[model samples]
Target: MSDSTAYTESAKILLLEDDLLLAMDMEDYLLDRGHEVVGPFGRLVDALDAIPRNELAGAVVDLNLHGELSFPVIEELQARSVPIIVCTGYAELPEVKTRLQGLPLLPKPWTAHKLSSLMEETFGATQEPRDAPPSKIRN
Candidate 1:
């Protein structure tokens, strides 16, 4: 996976997960796959603010962030038609099922392979710029 040829057009992806360790790992994986990451934002407010500022092609979102439901973040992304892949441990929550019907949902403890594959399917081919470092939106 060192080569970027297999990735979809280099797209900016929003990462909304609260766990520091998990977010770091995901950021590394997305960067390795040639996608610019907007933020591994721990707070929903931070992620929501970054959304309007970046041109996000897709997202990997967590259902709960530090105990708060992230429905507003999901809805904002939905309104923009940016593809989303929900990555959370709380997938069984009724609100998750009700609001995010039909979207891809990858449970917690997922592999980098599963995440990348879904991203590829959603965004098509990842573009080159192989040497470019992945970017992040800091707030």
Candidate 2:
């Protein structure tokens, strides 16, 4: 949890994308929202290495990094029980599809409001129309 009074709070955001401009934009946007954007990493390997260390409440991911699929990074975040938001220009593979369950997916060229709403839903900040039954994670 973060301090409510903090103007700019901290969250460990692991973003993997090769596009330098996009990476910087995401980092800045998340930071402005009072989050600690950890890596706007352009490489898959560096993003993978950093995922396990942060106290993350949420994540936003670009599905491909430097021509490599970022499924491994998603797996690591899932293992840590962090809620993740995915941004993809392409369709997800079988592995990512199966692992995602009913989580929301935001395609590329999204607005800030969409990202904010989805992330809020993940963080228990939004109330579902009907109460969702509490579920447990196996393994």
Candidate 3:
């Protein structure tokens, strides 16, 4: 599909996943859809550090990052009021269910179509890109 077909406007999405291959695939998909991807951070500390340094339109975060729970990342995104979609294989875990009660959960092995749809739903169709200065990580 063409990059502009799904949504007229693109967004900057933060990606936090531990699996290198999976992260690359997701980054490619987001890029193809005309969205810029922030860190596909495999480490919790790195992901946390990137948060404040970037202006994120939304986030797609895995629940686990190298055996560490990503609750802090989720909390930080929530605090910023940035939309998040938990793309996790551990959605059924008690801790995940309890902690991420209302957040959207996109189970692992997600389809591009589903991701696009959910992104549009969460962020809407016509987003005006933020006027803030470029993200430090990008430079």
Best by TM-score: 1
- Total colliding residue pairs, candidate 2: 1
In candidate 1, what are the lDDT values of residues 1-139, reduced to their tens digit?
Answer: 1122233456778899999999999888778667778888999889999987877778899888888988899889888788888987777779768777887887889786677677767666353335666555564
Task: Return whichever of 1 and 2 wins on lDDT.
Answer: 1
Per-residue lDDT over 17-131 for candidate 3, one digit per residue giving the tens place of the 0 to 100 score: 8999998888777766667678778888888888877677888999888788899999998888888899888888896798889888888888877787777777663323344
lDDT winner = 1
TM for every model, in the order presented, reads 0.84, 0.73, 0.81
Please give, for residues 2-110, the per-residue lDDT of candidate 2 as tens digits. Answer: 3332121344555666788877776666666556566777766777777666566676788777678778888787777767788876656777677665767877876
lDDT of 2: 0.64
C-alpha local distance difference test of each model: 0.77, 0.64, 0.75
Query: Which stretch of 10 consecutive residues in model 3 shows the poorest summed lDDT?
Result: 1-10
Q: Which stretches of candidate 3 lie over 4 Å from their true place?
A: 1-8, 125-139
In TM-score terms, candidate 1 sits at 0.84
lDDT of 3 at 61: 91
Counted clashes in each candidate structure: 8, 1, 0
